[model samples]
Target: MIVQVALATGFVLILIGIYGALTQRNLLRMIVAFTVANSGVNLVIVAVGYLPGRTAPILDATVPAAEAAARIIDPVPQALVLTAIVIGLGVTALMLAFAYKLYEKRRSLDIARFSELKW
Candidate 1:
């Protein structure tokens, strides 16, 4: 129930981000939209990896190794999402830095102001 809602929400956010990125003329706005889309992707990955009534993939006294497979949720998606988040943050930072540099050079953040970037 909740998972489905989360999945739907993530998809909606992704759609909104894509729409904003495509329609926005400002470099900052496009960066924001891409960030939103990245967040949505992370959310969807986490939601998909979640399992009800399951524990983390840790082996402790409560969860013996014999039953670990059935008791714990898969950790791959979560790990992947975490990595993606770090990479995405770095990418966003680099993008913002470039935008700032471009703005400094042109005194404008509008995409059209940079004609050389079009080609």
Candidate 2:
């Protein structure tokens, strides 16, 4: 039930991000929207790997080795999400830098006003 809610929330955030990215004119706003979408993708990935009654994939005296595979949540998706988050942060930073450069060159943040670069 909780996972369902999380997945729904993630999906909604992704849709909102897509809408914002598509409609916004400012480069900064578009970059922010992409970041939001990236976050939603991470949430969905984590939620998909979550198990309702499972514990973390850690060994202890309480949990026997034989049952560990069945009792613990899968860690691969979680690890992938973590990596993706770091990559997303780097991408967002790069986008922000590009936006800054664009603004510096054009003296405007609006994307529509920079059509002179066309080949």
Candidate 3:
């Protein structure tokens, strides 16, 4: 039940973020919405690896390493989500830089007004 709820919430957040990104024209708003969607995706990925009745993945003398490995949460999804987070940060930085340059060149923040770039 808990996992189901988490997954549903994540999907709903992702949908809302995508809708905002698609309909909103302001560059800053679009970037924020994209980040929102990325967060939702990250949440879902992390949730998928959760084990309800498992101990931590630490290998102390009390808990055997092999036993922990058998019941501990999956680490693969966590690792991939970390990578996704780094990539998302890079994309956000690049988008912000591009947006800043556009604002400087055009002296306007209205995305609609940026139609006729000299590109």
**Best candidate, lDDT-wise?**
1
lDDT for each residue of candidate 2 in 8-63, tens digit (9 for 90 to 100): 99999899999999999989889889989988999999999999999887889877
User: Model 1 lDDT vs. the true structure?
Assistant: 0.94
Count residue pairs with overlapping backbones in model 3.
0
Candidate 2 total steric clashes: 0
As for lDDT, the candidate ahead, 1 or 2, is 1
TM-score of each: 0.88, 0.90, 0.86
Local accuracy by lDDT, each model: 0.94, 0.91, 0.87
Ranking of predictions according to TM-score:
2, 1, 3
Residue 57 lDDT, candidate 3, scale 0-100: 58
Native-to-model Cα distance after best TM-score fit, residue 32 in candidate 3, in Å: 0.5
For model 2, the run of ten residues with the poorest summed lDDT: 56-65
Ranking by lDDT: 1, 2, 3
Error of 3 at 83 (Å): 1.3
